[model samples]
Target chain A: MAVDNASITEVVLGGTRGGPDVKTLREDKWWKLPLVTVLGLSAFVVYATWAAVWGDSNFFYLPHNIISPFYSPCLAHACKAAGDTGSPVFDWWRLSPALIILVFPLGFRMTCYYYRKAYYRSFWRAPVACAVQDARPGYTGETRAPLIIQNIHRYFFYAGLVFNVLLTIDAVQGFIWPTLHHQLVHGQYVTQSGGFGMSVGSLVLCVNATLLWIYSLSCHACRHLCGGQIRSFSKHPIRHKLWKFVTPLNARHMTFAWCSLFFVAFTDLYVRLVASGTITDFKIF
Target chain B: MADVTMRIWRGDDKGGQLVDYRIEGNEGEVVLDVIHRLQATQAPDLACRWNCKAGKCGSCSAEINGMPRLMCMTRMDQLPAGPVTVTPMRTFPIIKDLVTDVSFNFEMAKRVPAFNPPPAPEGGYRMAQVDVERGQEFRKCIECFLCQNVCHVIRDHEDNKAHYAGPRFFIRYAELEMHPLDTNDRRELVRERMGLGLCNITKCCTEVCPEHIKITDNAIIPLKERAVDAHYDPVAWLGRKITGRKKRSADEAAALRP
Candidate 1:
């Protein structure tokens, strides 16, 4: 039944809700969560920025073949300085390769279903928490303008999978250390492969790649790609199988997201320390 | 046991006010218990709806302490000192004090396509326990509509209510879509007709869900991915064509059936 005549009257709601003009009626420490989120995410951003831009040179360890995930697929001309193979195609590019490669994975995380919530609540304060007032009175969300670009998350997911593959290759290469074999062919000297070996740097890179793979596979888009559209699982057996495998992973996407994020930076730091001779890359073989 | 002051909203669709009531509240008493005591001793004409005070009925839903929660479940002692503000769910039009016109949710529920499983095999359709577990997780929903109340798509935007099915029904769609035996395709329905894209996946719905259903992750996000699979992904489209398999919508499948 419609109560058409009940006049909309302004009154003191209670607690935090002083009135209609009041932002929220929440009495608890509501700001704590958003504040923590801001600090955590901001620290990650700051660290990521430092690693990507300022510490670009120390991202590769030649003896252990440990490559930082941030500078992976080391396609720059400068990669040769670190004893990593450099692609001739990217020889013309002068800047840090991390800048070129980071955009893809960055986009993936920024538009992620979980990250969107984290940043939206913490950064934008778009109704920071339940029943809380929005920072902006009018909420357009991802419905318009720049935020609407989030529809490209699947594209970023695809891009992220490529990065995962590249990182996994880096991890595998981490197991192959440089040999002491020096040969004189004509007038030049060449070093031979150390074959299969391992180091502390190798384990760090391995864990980094593993976490990235888990994060990529556990992605909401990847999970969708598996069995999301299948009308009947009985028909698409392979997809159904893949879907089953990723379902549990997708549930822990948030954990993997944070773990992989931190581990990526740690992998970089480990590589940098070894490359700069700040720390020793102890052989584990 | 202590004296508690409750600032409960009182009024109708037009407007309302937070009317305070001081009542003798026990330590073990719930918000609903206090409201009942107030009704018995203090305010005889206080308007509020309640049933099955054990949190199962899904009634007695209100915004206690500015959080959408079941009044039956919120204990008196859990709340901090001073007045506990109890208000009608902000999402829907208030009918009276704590009651809202949750008929919006009912209308949305009616629009959800029914589960259309393929005809049962002989005696009965048997399934593995692992296959049923996913649906079981979604089945824990008690129709509290707290998810709906907290969802920003409809809660904030009144106009969006026409197109958006909100989180409650999104889970309903997800349940039917993910059902192993079910054949109905709701990808286009949810994406186009039900305004699924309007949901930015902020996950306010998940936060308020009393049943702890992963409404955003398990339900809405999966539905979005399914919609992407059908509408956006060229690879899936080509694969479907090469396989010569066309998944029909509910209408198309229904039209073909006897």
Candidate 2:
């Protein structure tokens, strides 16, 4: 085939050389998207910070013992005496319990494939929308100091899986209510004669866990883990099946990401409200 | 039998407008065919770039009805019954009607390190079928640059053009890096120079690829993994540090392998 370099005319009609000279004359609803992203992300961050700092009342309903998603696996000495169930890694640290475990979930979201694009456009204004000029004059990508840590997303993913397991256990614990009678089992206080029932908190935690699972499982890293390195899908039937299952979720990864983020904060807020005696945990059963 | 209202963009760098033209459509004609007909009959000076009128040439890339598609491949019958809007790609600087300056892609191509293979064996360099198959998908790229045009890194952010290499060269890097016989550590170059970290794997580039190349899943993600392994993986970084071994040249690694 004859290479057609003729069409690519190098007519150097000079003005501004690097970027688009003419500003986009688009009258569409382009600004709404980035604005929504900024508002949503900002709200979540502000609420999360407040919730994380104000450590009291994060763990709720001592009878049901439903731990907030924010402070799950609450690793601090202070949590035990507050009549809340939490596995503290060290008793020495005298700080907000959320300080210990929030990093994993935060890192997971910060380095998330969807969230990266969201914040990069919304917060960084890296070409706020398609065909729009960015606020920055140049781009260095994620090669720099702090952004380079994004390459550790896979590791954060592993940490996220561990947190998911802990949160799932917490959700399951939300179901078992402590009776009038109690016993000691395996050097821990055990609740006996508990019945199967559900509360709004339990349902909220379940929904939060489910949504997070969907979001994490649908992650681009998760998809890559499922089927990326494999050269031949035909040879690996099991991986192929897994990939097929994940394909649909991967298609809607953005939806899952946003929904899970909101639900997580909601889950934490709900527990905080219940702990503070602001809202009653309505029983579903 | 029917006349299709073809709205084509016509103007230079100063300004442009979508000028409507009534062009007669044949029974089984593509969008490029209609443009060619318009060029021949009504508007002789209507500037459009195309070659090989078949899909292989990659020269006739333009957005038809707000979607990036090859002019030769997009059949008129497939479109809805209305005026078809044809315009230059949004990513690059438009030179004229339906023709954007695609030199950005060429400039990125130059920055990629040339493939350096080790000295051939006693007879010649022999590559396994599996190794060859790995790069086959990427090699299908005809340099249409539809991937670059649709890529949000550069397409959305014009400034990103300075840093990001877009999807096209990432595939090129993948082909060279994954080739069994070839040896070159372009991971650092991909990380720093080509701006591999910018791709958030929206899969928009993959979606728009005419050749159906899994650009995100195959090329970009794997390149990311390689970069992470080289630079970020703590154990690997420690191992590299302890051994005091720099990146081996193609010949050095090949000589040590046997």
Candidate 3:
């Protein structure tokens, strides 16, 4: 039987359609896809800027109050006994302020796997989005600039990994210190100083964050993994392990990407609580 | 079932118009199959380019309606039916109906310096096995030029042609950069002359690739890293000076480099 014009139909028409001169106007070149990307990035700036002024300052407090929670829990108890509830309001202001300062970089952050993929598709054939050029097609598939930022994703992977490990260390410190015996017999809420177990646990959280960062950075299947490198891979002992670990991370990069995002927030939260007093840093004698 | 229409662009650059053709085939039938039937019964003069029909060889590149694709792999069922359009590669000048001048890529390939390995006669250069494997993965590239077909540097802005070498060129640069035995320094050539920084790593080429090469990460990215190391990293600068042997540049022989 002969197929008629009525029998077949075009399926797979890509992207949303609607423009002022839909039929007459040609698709725009070097299209800047106003995705949730640029706008969503701005949200980080707004939040970060607000956090600088309104949030806690304790995030910057490094190994001092934090390390004690892990190695010696009893001190937290003593500090808590001597603590004033009014400090929490000050602590909140201490921790979150710098994160607010970091908004500009986040907005321009080039570590996005999604942006890499979207632009690859967009510019290769549709720098004009999904719209096609009707006037005699005279184009070659290639990429253009601003794509230069892809170099940073690798560094981001390394930096994020280190940062997440530190965050986890901070969380573990909280759990560890709570287990330690506070020798502050004079304190209201007395507790014992935690043993090596708590210390180990805190370390585990730090390592957990590190793993999340590895997934974010080494992601092989993510959009950033789209290009080719000139050099063939060498079978270095360290390089081999990195690839194996990164493969799974790359396999589910999106999951880890979101997880670390929340992890960062959680890190900020713990610091706020210790500074504020809602979550007491009690000393056990 | 409705009849599927194909408005094929027929003619050389002199002038042409959309020539319509109709054929009967299953929805899943690839666009190449439709063209085959058209060849058998319709206008035989209708020119097309193809090879392994399995989406390999990178031979069957054309724009269906306006999108670049391997006609052999495109399914008839997937396209809209008002008039199923078939045309040649747009980036290059047309040779005839559905055939474009893709020799430009080949010509570009000629400009790339050929590979010259380290000249240690006794111990052929001891490269770590891991490093060799890294290069082999990118070496799997089949030169589909699909990445070239999809790049905006060539597609939207024609002016970039002078300075911007397409992704395929970068792949060549990358192959040399990773080769264990290669000893030519193409980093400056790739960065300053080849325009390596122009690629944003969107990976459109990898997406369109039939060979499944990781065009961006495996090739373009490593090349970018090399450029960085060449220009920014102190250790690499010293290493290059002491070695006397230049870093590897390409896999081709001396005749290949333009």
lDDT by residue (B40-130, candidate 2, tens digit) is 9998998888999888989999877756789999999988888888878878887777888888888677566667777777988765564
Residue-level lDDT of model 3, residues A9-28, one tens digit each, is 23221211111122222223
Give the candidate order by descending DockQ: 1, 2, 3
Q: Which ten-residue region of model 1 chain A has the weakest summed lDDT?
A: A9-18
Model 3 RMSD, rounded to 1 decimal: 11.1
Which is superior by DockQ, 1 or 2?
1
* Candidate order by decreasing lDDT: 1, 2, 3
TM agreement with the true structure for every prediction: 0.86, 0.74, 0.67
The C-alpha stretches of model 3 lying farther than 4 A from their native spots are: A1-96, A99-108, A111-162, A177-212, A216-255, A262-285, B15-20, B78-83, B119-133, B234-258
lDDT of 3 by residue, B19-43 (tens): 8887677657888988878888888
- Can you list the residue pairs that collide in candidate 2? none
Alpha-carbon runs more than 4 Å astray in model 1: A1-21, A86-89, A143-148, A180-197, A228-241, A283-285, B117-132, B240-258
lDDT by residue (A162-196, candidate 1, tens digit) is: 99899889889988766746643222354756889
Please give the TM-score that candidate 3 achieves against the real structure.
Answer: 0.67
Q: In DockQ, how does model 2 score against the reference complex?
A: 0.14
